[model samples]
Target chain A: MKHFIVGPVETYKEVQNIYKQPYLYFRSNEFGEFVKETLNRLSSLIGNNDKNSLLYLTMSGTGAMEATIENCVTPKDKVLVINGGTFGQRFCELLKFHNIPFDSINLKWNESLTKEHLEYYENKGYTTLFVNLHETSTGQLYDVKLLSEFTKRNNMFFIVDAISTFLADTYDMSKYNIDVTIISSQKGLCLSPGLSFVSLSKRIIDKIYKTTPSSLYFDFKDYLKNIERGQTPYTPAVFIMYELKAILDLIDNSGGLEKWLSNIKEKCQYFREQICKIGLNIPTTYNLSNTMTPVICDTVNANELVKYLRDHYEICVNPCGGNRANYMFRVSHIGNTTKKDIDILIDKIQKTIEVLAKRN
Target chain B: MKHFIVGPVETYKEVQNIYKQPYLYFRSNEFGEFVKETLNRLSSLIGNNDKNSLLYLTMSGTGAMEATIENCVTPKDKVLVINGGTFGQRFCELLKFHNIPFDSINLKWNESLTKEHLEYYENKGYTTLFVNLHETSTGQLYDVKLLSEFTKRNNMFFIVDAISTFLADTYDMSKYNIDVTIISSQKGLCLSPGLSFVSLSKRIIDKIYKTTPSSLYFDFKDYLKNIERGQTPYTPAVFIMYELKAILDLIDNSGGLEKWLSNIKEKCQYFREQICKIGLNIPTTYNLSNTMTPVICDTVNANELVKYLRDHYEICVNPCGGNRANYMFRVSHIGNTTKKDIDILIDKIQKTIEVLAKRN
Candidate 1:
């Protein structure tokens, strides 16, 4: 089946083969070298100087986000969360769970953050600003440049959950002044779901050392000690590490992040253009991410459209839950998606619309 | 290379094949059914009642242990940890980190937990008892029957880390009256090292609901809510779950846990007998686990012996760290280990001893 759902997206052949190899011993020097090399590659991809520390967590993207919150956010300092979509709401949920004092700038599903919204939090004394750079729910890409400048001017640490944006967009930790950037394997990495990566600048590391977290699994101090020797404190997803290396190598071999990001941009642009031609509404007029396109339906049910595509064409598209379940469906352009695949999907969706009208 | 090191252990062909399949979308009904089925299979294997809830954590054994501690033990509760080896000490570390008031029964590495030791903690107002059923570091298997009766009489909750011994031994959660049983995939299940599982009784679940844990990744309440619908709060190690189902099916096909346990017992017994014949000392003469055997070296350095085997025969053995670095080496009998493999390992060890003696 052709998979267009957001993540646990289509995987590369070599990466899947790497995952198929028997599990490597986590304590072996060979695995240590692999860990070191992967960290170096990640550092280069994110444009990190040697002053930062990157950690590989054996969990989902949400797990990595929770880890960052637990390690960085304390009740003593105030935080401001940008709530635009499901992933952004997750950061709010995490903050609430930890009882961290925080407020949110809730953007409507199809809306983007503007300078007017930034002005409200300028002198309000939020020590940290948390956001989902590409909110997966609405396909709205939050302006990292504006947020970075605002946070830097106010001397607030910035944390970005780039789970769905890393490889699909040109992201640089140094350029954006992102203190912590969290990503996962299943998104733009095009690997399986399991491992989560967090890259932290020295500033965030210093604050993390000073603060005490409520978690043992995501304790930064323990990770810092183990990562110095190219290991985690506990056993990680061994095969996923190998797959990550394979994907990283693929990106590097194909002219690195610049080429990879442009490829995704082209795919997303082509998909959006076709959807517009098919008379569907794009959910957002703002800068959209090159990850997924959330299309709004007026006459037909989104669930029905997703079902029609899956049953007839053997293709899977994203089905929204909660309030938008019957209104919007998403199509991901990340992973190993191609222009030909998008064209086929558009044709199928066109047929689906006609069938829905007849049913009506 | 032949893997005799504790874990990540060797994998079976069918299990590897299952894991090789491309990633599955987590939000799909297909995955939800898989999750439900895997949990049911795990519950049946451990003899858990319908009232029990089993959670699959995307972490190592230690992470699961911390989850149990965080959700159950609070500052108001007094706890008793049974410290025998590395894993046992880990419980104390977690308890300390949480600031949960606790005392411990520090047993010698090879010593058994007898009735006399239990008498001290009995009726002492301890709310919970934490122990590692099999201490992986020392190859010592603690008696479950004795601890069960003591905890029951004392009206204390019992939490056991059965990581290295779960599939190798006969463990009945209902029979043992264990409130929580922790296990990892890399041990006797012999899959890969990515997922950890915890089985909890209804009583502990009630307490977990009332307590606010210091962690979000290890949050039991969030996990419980999502798991009721056959899901986790975050994306998990997708392929590892497939391998788990494959191994669980293999166990069920091979006459269930009873036969599987006996096979491991036979392998462990055969290995110990061969090493005894070779004039090597068994570190623990007490009740030993079928998972691994710790061989005590009096003449040559254990590290040197491990290195020699790896370099000459391409066999990897577990070398001790800290004080035991020069004294002992471990050989695992779990996974798909065979009698022929054991014979080959013994022959290589004999040659290693001879070579070390020549150097001396």
Candidate 2:
């Protein structure tokens, strides 16, 4: 009943406070101004060096990804997808659904993309490079700057799925040369899920014009047209937009993006130290995500451990899925989560594991 | 500065009360149960006889329409679109964007699709009939029962864009053999515009599996796959969903669907009578939509009248768009609209027209 699942995580009280105001339907000018302010705040957060970068807010992170592909890829256009975890695999699936031609470079679950991988794809003449900055499935963070540079050298469009990274990670669009960076409200923004945002550079916008026309609801061009008036082509989630505005204000007041990212890193480090003391191995040797920690157990059943903690200690954690289910479990330190929350989770997991190990 | 635009007219204080509840994310079982109960109540209101007529909600009415098309129409299949107003034109545009082969019968703004028009499309061998029950732009309501019969007789599918007509208008899916119906939370449902609902019969579900996989975000299969567990495929707008539950409960407590429809009809009659006294002409002789009345002014500028009323009387009404903008304006009686609201609008419009006539 209690959600420990990775996002739509707990929303901040300030985000909750905005929803209390009277609802303005999406068509209202009040909603329009809210959207405009949210975009302006996002641009500021991302450091608005690229005046040409347009932000399109959508229903979810997946909606943003769908918009990116639907707008950027035409039929038969060859795109290179870098797959390491579930989110990366989703990009390939999206490509397949659109019937766009794609070649994927599959990496191990916790592996980061090396420059060699990008160069190989570039040499193969892939027009776009699709990579996840932080793969939620494996708690791996790739160096997007390195990958962006490699793609730039080949004149390829660098599409980064930064859904799990974004505000919590230091990403300079100007430095990375990211053509399209996708993010969502739930992950690093400390808001509830339901909104997704994509910052598109001019180069990417030009490519979208040449791409095959997509469905009306997901049409990036249609969204862009409405963006001028601070409106979406359809009715957007107005309450979520309000929440986004409040969260953006909070971030601005909290020393902006740098302070937010440092706070996440600090919490992640604290959780990692606790995990080490508890004798649990981290699933990934590569860079871990600031949002969550995936730990591997030597002899404990990860699913059982998750359930025992939740049932007995009233603490929640996510049991790993797919091939990682038996040996791995994940604890999210994202959104409004704090050290106290992490301590409660770790303490519960430690006690639960000890009791379960003795019974076994 | 004030929103006098049609439905989403103004969210009720009761609806705002629901939204103000501390923001619980949708992943919680409490929120999930609320959504499930909301759907159940809506099903009863709209006369969904089949237990299998699944109700799936989306971010907006346009999102629901996009999902319907993505699920029902394959690229290889030909669809028949009935374009009578702005929403109908939108459906045609969606078909174009999706690259689905569609033949459209464009009717005049106030004209309703007759049996002859249906036979013409049927003879042309189209497999689907798309109708907008209440054309929001022109204020005309189609007899969906007749159109559904035509589709059934021709062995084709019937999909209705009932966005503005669902609860306010009478519709019996079983009697009419309607395959799919789409409606939104705003318009006739008297809720905010953030949510859109679609009810599908078994026949449409069968066809969706055969359709080429189009979009990931609005995919029906993904929704269906998750709805059994009372979950959406993505993170939904939790606060809005809570509002929907409150709205549906109010609908049930207010004597259910029959009483709701009668109330709409009575409101329309009163509005029409008042408009006639003000010397305005009801342009559409066909059954006027229960939700709104479109009035034509031979001498007064519709836009000017809208501005005068809003600026002077603090009253809001919709100025007709497209070809009708100069000659006509609309007043909606949909969603949480009371007789007092109608009286206020009518009084303001009469006074505004009198002042404008002197200036002319």
Candidate 3:
């Protein structure tokens, strides 16, 4: 309750202003137009080559992930999953739920994913490759472009869970030939957690037509059918949709895509520098996420450190969940987070660590 | 742009206040507890009877309807559906999608459904009966109690799409032996439109377990499995959950269930009386919904009158969509609507109708 837990990041005043009004119902044409405009802006931001690229909104980034698995794979379809952290394991869970056959290339939580893992799966004749562009659980960003090229060369569908990295990273869906890119409103979009979006390439859309429909609510075909009318198959999270529109306007007004990406880069660099100065090491050797940094502290208890920062300093950071909690804690730099906010977080964390050391 | 229309009645100020915050991420335990508490409050409001009754949430009222059908009936399964209004037509659509065999007892758009229909269907060996508590499109509220008794005597599963009725009507799920009851957040709950809920009796749960999985996302079993742990199978509408909690709190704080139902009844009476006083004939004799009034005005173009009211008087009223536009227009009395709001709406309608008569 004292604030620090990564995600659902403390929203800025401007972002909160949009959420204050009752969401105009989605059945109304006004909300429908807002969705259309938001999709156009996102398409422009991503530089999608296919004008027919479809954006389908879901409840969360996880929902989008489930949608990808449900929409892309049929029973007994072989899927190649790159597992580096909790999120990677999630793909395995989805595969299990659908009873689809999947082989996972397991990477250590502290390691970055390389192209070799994908190449291994390609040789094994896997028809679909699933990767997390930004593995939030481990704070590692994958070489998505390289993986996308490998999947394309192998004639396999490429799916990227870009939930935490989409806006922060240079994600050009056109250049990467990414078949499906998933994102959420809460992380990089800086809106809220209720909405997830999946942008579909024509290749994957075609594949979906052949796959068996497992879930009615997250059926990609259902989404595709209704999307033409600027409507979702089900009632969308209207307030989140409104917040997404507002956030898009803010992003567009803030010198557009390139500037926004640069801002994230700068923030990530600042965070990495601060972590290095504090003698903390980033867990993953691969490229770090622009959105968050998973740091390993030799002397600090990650969970206690998180609580100390929240209770004593009013700064919220996420303590890694499950097995990762022992050695790592994450600080997110996504959404409308600024250098000033990060600086405050750093100041609190430094003080907390010193007090924690004294107590030990 | 204008607000009125039957559904998505103006959200309460308190409900809007909760939506103003960034939706807390689903992984947060706080969010999970909030949803659990909301469900608990709903259970209390409905009055606890059977421990086997379960509340499940979906994206919209229609989504809940789809879930009810998809969960209970497999492909080629026999279903009895009452065809009366847009909502009932949606049940037909669900039946068509699942390729289920359905015998529909079609009632005229503005007609009431009686127990005789159920008796007729029961004799035909239909195991499942689908009915609407309030047919929102035609402003029809059926006698659910009579249908429930008939279904019980026949040992049939009774499903009710109570989207616009729920708290507005004096009915109990246990009393009617209604196996499945679906309602939306915005209509009777005074919340926004992002969430739909279904209350299932023990008999329906057993039927769902025996049925083959139809949809992954809309699977009632998955929802029921996770609901006990205060979790949803996917990311839920977090902010709406918060708003629902707030609305429930407000409802409870304001003298609980009895008071809320009484307020709705009072608003319905006031609106119906005002419409009659303004020389508009009620469209249906026996099936008037407490949540809204469908008025027949043959002298003026209903669409033009609705537009004039919105543009000139700054009053939002929905012009009926499609074929229904020529014969009737509806004004809703759901959520936090009061006599004052109804009076303003009636006044605007009177002026608009007078101006339309002059123009014609």
In candidate 3, how many Å is residue B216 off? 3.5
Shift in Å, residue B307, candidate 1:
2.4
Candidate-wise lDDT, in order: 0.86, 0.75, 0.74
**lDDT of residue A298 for candidate 1:** 82
Give lDDT tens digits, candidate 2, residues B1-360.
Answer: 233355665655677675335444354465567666667667666667555356556467888887888888877778988888788998998888777899888888877668777666656677888888888888888877778777877788888888887776787766787788888766776565566778888888777766655677877877876666668876665556777777666766779767868987898889899889878899756777677888898778888887787668766678887767778988877655677877788888888888998999
Clash number by candidate, in order: 0, 1, 3
Model 1, position A1, has a per-residue lDDT of: 76
What DockQ does each candidate score versus the true complex, computed on alpha carbons?
0.59, 0.41, 0.37
Q: How big is the positional error of residue A198 in model 2, measured in Å on the Cα after superposition? A: 1.7
Model 1 C-alpha lDDT per residue in residues B1-360, reported as the tens digit of each score: 788877888778778776446544677777788788888888878778663298998888888898888898899999998898888899999899999999989987668778898887778899899999988888888899999998899899999898988888888998989999899988888877788888999889999999987777888998888887778888887778888888888988888788888998999899999999998989655788888999998778888998899878888889886788788999999987799999999999999999998898
How far in Å is the alpha carbon of B214 misplaced in model 1? 1.3
Clashing pairs in 3: A4-A316, A19-B20, A215-B216
Over the full model, what C-alpha lDDT does candidate 3 score relative to the true structure? 0.74
Tens digit of lDDT per residue, candidate 3, span A270-330? Answer: 9889878988887546788677777887687777887677666656678888866766788
Q: Put down candidate 1 lDDT per residue, A165-277, tens digits, no spaces.
A: 88888889999899999999889888777788899999889889987888788888889878877899988888778888888889889887888888888898888888999
TM per candidate: 0.96, 0.89, 0.90
